[model samples]
Every structure is written in C-alpha cells, then in structure tokens.
Target: MIVATGDYHVLTDILVILERWTICHRRYHHCATSLRLKCTEL
Candidate 1:
C-alpha cells in the first residue's frame, strides 16, 4: 500500500511538470511569433 501511494505521488508530480512544460512552451511560442512579426515590420 505504501508503494502504491508513492507511485501515485510520483505520477502526480510528473503530470504537474508536463502541464507546466506545455504551458510554458505555448507561451514561448506565442512570444517568439510576436517578436518575429515585429522584426519583420522593422
């Protein structure tokens, strides 16, 4: 039972990391695109 609980905690942590990574990646892409557009305009 303890092992199972530990595994669950690990899985939850991994999920949180993945979620944050995806969100950061999306924001980075958005910022990059806007910067590219600005550079093109200049």
Candidate 2:
C-alpha cells in the first residue's frame, strides 16, 4: 500500500509538469504565429 501511494504521488507530479509545459508551449506558439502575421503585413 505504501508503494502504491508513492507511485501515485509521482504520477501526479509528472502530470502537473506536463500540463504546465503544454500551456506554455501553446501560448508561445500563438505568440509566434501572431508575430509572423504582423511581419508579413509589414
């Protein structure tokens, strides 16, 4: 039971990290696209 609990905690931590990374990546991608569009317009 103790081992299972430890594994669960590790999984939760990994999930949190992945979620943050995905959000940052999405925001960066969006900003890059917007910048590209503006450059093209110029």
Candidate 3:
C-alpha cells in the first residue's frame, strides 16, 4: 500500500475532523435528551 505524503496528510486531517464532529454530535444529542427529559418533568 503506497500512499503519497500529501494524500496521507489530507487523510489524517479528514479523520481528525470526523472524530471531532462525532464527539460534538454525541454531546449535542446527550444535551438534547436531557433537556427533553427536564421539560417532561416540568
């Protein structure tokens, strides 16, 4: 498997971005669920 240096860098950047996005999305989903639960309790 031969990958160009530049392509490898780009792929690494994309993976980092995807990891950050997934973390953020999970946090947002958790917050939304909590808010909904609080609203229902009120």
Candidate 4:
C-alpha cells in the first residue's frame, strides 16, 4: 500500500511536469510564428 501511494505521487508529479512542458512548447511555437510573420513583412 505504501508503495502504491508513492507511485501515485510520482505519477502526479510527472503529469504536472508534462503539462507545463506542453504549455511552454505551445507558447514558444506561437511566438516563433508571430516573429516569423513580422520578419517577413519587414
């Protein structure tokens, strides 16, 4: 039971990290696209 609890905690941490990573990845992609468009216009 203790092991299961530990595993669950670890899983939650990993999920949180993955969620943050994806959020940052999306924002980076959006910023890159906007910058590219601006550069093209210039």
Give residue 6's lDDT in candidate 1 (0 to 100).
Answer: 80
Candidates 1 and 3 compared: the better one by TM-score is 3
Q: What is the TM-score of each candidate against the true structure?
A: 0.58, 0.55, 0.60, 0.56
Task: Identify the superior model by TM-score, candidate 3 or candidate 4.
Answer: 3
lDDT of each: 0.65, 0.65, 0.68, 0.65
RMSD of 4: 9.5
- Please give, for residues 1-42, the per-residue lDDT of candidate 4 as tens digits: 356888999999889877766666655655776654543342
lDDT of 1 by residue, 1-42 (tens): 356888899999889877766666655655777654543342
lDDT of 3 by residue, 1-42 (tens): 999999999999889877766666655655777654544342
CA deviation > 4 Å runs, candidate 4: 1-3, 30-42
Best by TM-score: 3
Query: What residue runs in model 3 are displaced by over 4 Å at the alpha carbon?
Result: 30-42
Q: Global CA lDDT of candidate 2, please?
A: 0.65
Clashes (backbone N, CA, C under 3 Å), per candidate, total: 0, 0, 0, 0
Q: Give the per-residue lDDT digits (tens) of candidate 2, residues 1-42.
A: 356888999998889877766666655655777654544342
Higher-lDDT candidate among 3 and 4? 3
